[model samples]
Each structure stands twice: as C-alpha cells, then as structure tokens.
Target: MQNMSLRLRGLWADRSGLAAVEFAMIFPIMVAMYFGVVEYSSAISVDRKATQVARTLADLTSQSQTIADADLMSFGQAAKAIMTPYPGQPLVSYVTQVYIDSSTGAARVQWSKELVIDGAGNVTISGTAPHTQGTTVTLPSTLSVAKGTFVVWSEISYKYTPAVGYLVSKTGMTFRDVAYTRPRLVLCVTYPTAGFSNCATPL
Candidate 1:
C-alpha cells in the first residue's frame, strides 16, 4: 500500500502538460492584445489617410480657376487621385453626393459623405447639410459670388478590414476621421472693374 501511495504522489508531481497549461492560459490574452494593436494601428492609418484625402479635395477645388459643373467632374477625378492605396470605388461613390453651400448668407460649399461601415456593417454618410441618399454627393445654393468667397467642404470616409478578426468585433472600435478645409480663395472675389454702371456688375 505504501508503494502504491508513493507512485500516486510521483504521478501528481510530474511536470508534463505544465507548458501546455501555461500556453493555454496566456494564448488568448496575447491574441487579444495583438488584435488591439492592429486595430489601433489601422485607426491611426485611416486618420492620416482621411486628412490626405481632405487636403487633396480641398486643394483641387480651391486652386482650380473655376468651380463649375464641368470642373466638378475634375474634382471627382482629383478625389480618386488623393485617396491612394485604398480602393477608389468607395471614395468615388461618395464624391457624387458632395454639396457646395451656396446659401445667400453663407459663403461655403458644404460637401460631406461617409466612407466606412457602421458597427452594424451598414454604409453611412454625413454632411453639413442634408443630402440625397446615394454614393457621390453635391449641394446647390444661391451663389453670392460677389459678397464673399465660397467655403468648400470636402469629406471622405472608409471602413477598415479586420487584420485580426479573431478577437473583437464592434462598431465604435472603428471610426471615420472627417476633415474640413475652407477654400484658399475664400477671401478673394471676381467682379467688374468699375463697381457697377460701366462694367457688367459690381463684385
């Protein structure tokens, strides 16, 4: 009976399977942390890309000699240029819904759209003003061309894929960094040389 008891004790003291137990205990935590880092990194990248896209759109619209209908097409093409690396399809789709705030009182072209999927995996868009429910966007208002320069509002969004899908899945875990820039020409104006009577119209 004593020999049997000694054998049971030796069996209980054996270290076999210890490493597997430790690995099992630590593996999930390590995986969670890894995914967290990836999510954070993706978020940072998206933020930087969002800024680039906004600046590109703003620069293109502002530097152009004119912001007319034909020129707007160029603006779309310009958007495609700025949003590199990421597929242009989503961004291009959002561009169609841009709106330039031409309200008589306000000198601004308000353009806005969503680029990423919500927590629910739904495509969404937002704007300074209401917009049509579609991919690309545009807004129209009375152009007070003479009084003040027009404000150009450009917005873009994109959803990130889960590089580490094993850990977490939620909406707020992802975000879109929307950006805004006023046209550089906002302070300038184009009008007739002689106020009114002599020229076509006052600036």
Candidate 2:
C-alpha cells in the first residue's frame, strides 16, 4: 500500500510528456478553429462576389438604352463569370426596371425579369407575367429617381454552405444584396422580349 502511494506521488510529480498530452487534448480544437477561419473567409469572399455580381448586372443593364434577349443572356454570363472561381455555387438574380410616375408620384415596377442558376449548371428564367408591375413599392426618398425616369433594380441571392464553421447559423446561409441605379445613357431601359416592353410601353 505504501509503495502504491509512492508510485502515485511519482506519477503526479512527473512532468514528462505533459506538453504533448495537453497538445493532444487541444489539437482537435485548434484544427476546428483553423478550419473555421478558412470557411469564414470563403463565406466572406462569396458574399462580396455576390454583391459585385448584383452591382455589375445593374450597372451593365442600366447602361443600355434597350435590352434584347441576347443582351440579357450576355449579362447573365457576366454574372456567372463573377462567380467563376467558386464552381458549382450558383447565382440567382433579378433585374427590374422601375418607373417613377409623374401622375401618381409613386414608383412602380415597369418590367421585371428573374433568373436562377443552380449548382448543376441549370438556368431557369421566369416567363410568367411580371406581377410587380405597377406595385407601389417606394424607393428611398433620399435618392432622386425623378418623375418619368426609370431606374434599374438588381437583387442577388446566394446560398453558401460552410464546410466547417461555427459562425454559420444553418447549412444554407443565404446572402442577399440589392442595388438601384438610374440609366446612365438612357432615360429608361426596357426588356424587348417580355410583352414587347419598350421605352414608351414598358410592361
């Protein structure tokens, strides 16, 4: 019994391999943190790319006086290019030309188009009637989209799945961004394919 106690005391006093034991215990946590940092960085990069995608679409579309089906396809390609490095992550976007009515002093959706691209490289375009047409969704008062003028509204949404990050709330974290800009080269832009939308009869 006395030798057993002595052995126990010797074991307690021996500090050999202490650092290795502690490192072994904490190794998993350190790995987790490292992977979390990588995932977090990836998320931030994707979010920023999504934002740039929205802005790029809006900017490119707004520059055009009139947009045809082929032009819109080009814009879609541009958006897809912005997300090139991260393959398989799709980009869903909407481009709406909103009109500020002089008669009603309200902003309404003149024409809207939506596009969805999935991980498998499937592109879905909305063909149904644009519902937001004439919907009274007001714009920010601070900005001035004058009466009889048109502004391009772009919205982008991306679903990011973190590989290993504790900061993520769910498996699919959706990041959304919206931007609006008046036409740079034209008073109004129109989708020529949808209901034959034009500068005068944008529907």
Candidate 3:
C-alpha cells in the first residue's frame, strides 16, 4: 500500500508531461494562423488579377480607332482569357452608357459591370446596360468624342473564386471586377471591315 501511494505521489508531481500538453493546446491556433495567412494572400492575388483584366481591356479599347459595334464581343472574349485560375466559374459581361453634351454637342461614355466569382473556376459574360445616376459615372462630353456623336460605354464583369475556401466565409466568397473605357478616336469604319486592320496598325 505504501509503495502504491508513493508511486501515485511521484506521478502527480512529475512535470515531464507539461511541454506536450502545452504544444497540443497551441498547435491548432498555429495551424489556423497559417491558414489565415494563406487566405489573405489568395484574396490579394485575386484582386490583382481582377484589376489586370480590367486594365487590359481598357487599354485595348483605347488603342483602337476602328472599333466596330461587333468588336465588343472580342473585348468580352479577351476579358475572360485574362481572368484565369479562379476557383469559381468565371464570366465576362459589359454595359455601355452614352451621354451627349447639349451645349457643345460633344459626346462622353461610361461603363460599369459586376464581375461575379463562383465556387468553381469557370467564366461567362453578362450585363450591358445604361447608368442612370452618380457623378463619376458620368464623363465629360468633350473629353474626346466628336460633336453630335454617340459615345459607347462598356462595363465588363468576371467571377472569381478563392483558393483557400476554408479560411474565408463560404457565404459571398466569390469576387467581382468591373472596368470602363470610352472611345479615344472616332474612325468612319463599320464592322467586318478592314478598319480593324488599319486601327490595329502600330503607332
């Protein structure tokens, strides 16, 4: 009985198990923190990609003077090409709003669209409408368009999904990006014409 009692006391007094117990307690927290970091970086990457796609589309529009009505379809295709690797099904959609100055007869255009990111990585295009309000949404009539001319505003949208789903909230996990660009120059060219060739000619 005495030997058993001594053994029990020794076991109760030993400090060897403290380190293992502490590590077990903190391991989950460390893992969670690591995952949080991954999630943050993933979000940042997606944002940059979204921005790049928008900028690329805008630049493409600005560089051309022979943009025809049908070229809008090409723009949508290019937007989708740029926004790859996202987990959600990705899509490209655009809206075009035209504004004309009553006094100067100059024209201005603006665009705004939603880029929806789904749970899996796939892309599609939707949304082509006019804006009815706000200041920034409206551009100057004399910014570049010719007098009494119509301005075309296009809004492009793409859907993106995060890589680290476990880190971010499952609800509203997708992302959206929109971009707009007005015609820099007006060329008297119609669709399916050689205008694109001349417009695309390097300056």
Best by TM-score: 2
Q: Candidate 2 lDDT, tens digit per residue, 49-76? A: 8999899989999999888767776787
- Cα lDDT tens digits for candidate 3, 129-152: 344322224454445554444344
lDDT: the better of candidates 2 and 3: 2
What is residue 166's positional error in candidate 2, in angstroms?
Answer: 5.5
Residue 128 displacement (Å), model 2:
3.0
- The TM-score ranking, best first, is 2, 3, 1
Worst lDDT run of 10 residues, candidate 1, spans 193-202
Q: Give the C-alpha miss distance for residue 182 in model 3, angstroms.
A: 4.8
Query: Residue 123, candidate 2: how far off, in angstroms?
Result: 3.9
In model 3, how large is the Cα lDDT of residue 171? 47
Against the reference, the lDDT scores of all candidates come to 0.46, 0.79, 0.51
For candidate 1, the lDDT comes to 0.46
- For residue 134, model 2's alpha carbon misses the true position, in angstroms, by 3.5
- Which candidate model has the greater lDDT, 1 or 3? 3
lDDT at 12 for candidate 2?
Answer: 97
Candidates 1 and 2 compared by TM-score, better number: 2
